[model samples]
Target: AQSVTQPDIHITVSEGASLELRCNYSYGATPYLFWYVQSPGQGLQLLLKYFSGDTLVQSIKGFEAEFKRSQSSFNLRKPSVHWSDAAEYFCAVGGDGNNRLAFGKGNQVVVIP
Candidate 1:
């Protein structure tokens, strides 16, 4: 069985501060990892993905993630978080190119001025 778990349901951070979101997974084989950001009442945008090769992958909007095979984790990190970055983040695992994705509940991020 493959599953994604986001331990933090919500996170609050001051604007312009660094941010990190944790993601852990359980899969029988190598899984396709992805991080998506969803604004309020909008569709998800792909933050990054880890298929193979490089363990460290960069995404748009200055977001980056590193795949740690030993830990079965792919954590997201941002050097500086902006007010606009305050949105729901979801971790997903793609299964067998079926176009079906299993997503974590999501982590609500709050940015304080």
Candidate 2:
């Protein structure tokens, strides 16, 4: 069985401030972790992913994630956030040998200018 958990339900940050969203996952085999962002009333957009090699992967809109197998955690970080970055972010783990993914409840971010 596999599951993802995002400890933060909501986060608020001022424009140009740093942001970090926590994510933890449980998987039996090699885990494929991903971060997806969804704007208000919009579909989810792929942020980044970590499958193999290098611990870090970069995605669209200045987002990056690091995967730690030992800690079973894949946290998302942005050096600086813009007001338009406000969205609901989800952390997901891919099924072993399958394309299916199990996503967390999501962390909602609010940006203030």
Could you give candidate 1's per-residue lDDT for residues 12-108 as a string of tens digits? 9999999999999887777899999999999998889988999999987999999998998989999999999999999998766546777888889
TM of each candidate vs. truth? 0.94, 0.95
**Position 94, candidate 2: lDDT:** 92
lDDT of 2 by residue, 1-113 (tens): 78999997999999999999999999999998889999988999888988899998887789889998889999999999999999999999996677789999999999999
Error of 1 at 38 (Å): 0.5
Best by TM-score: 2
Candidate 1 structure lDDT: 0.90
Cα deviation of 59 in candidate 2 (Å)?
1.7
Candidate 2: residue 91 lDDT (0-100): 97
Error of 1 at 98 (Å): 5.4
**Reference-based lDDT, each prediction:** 0.90, 0.92
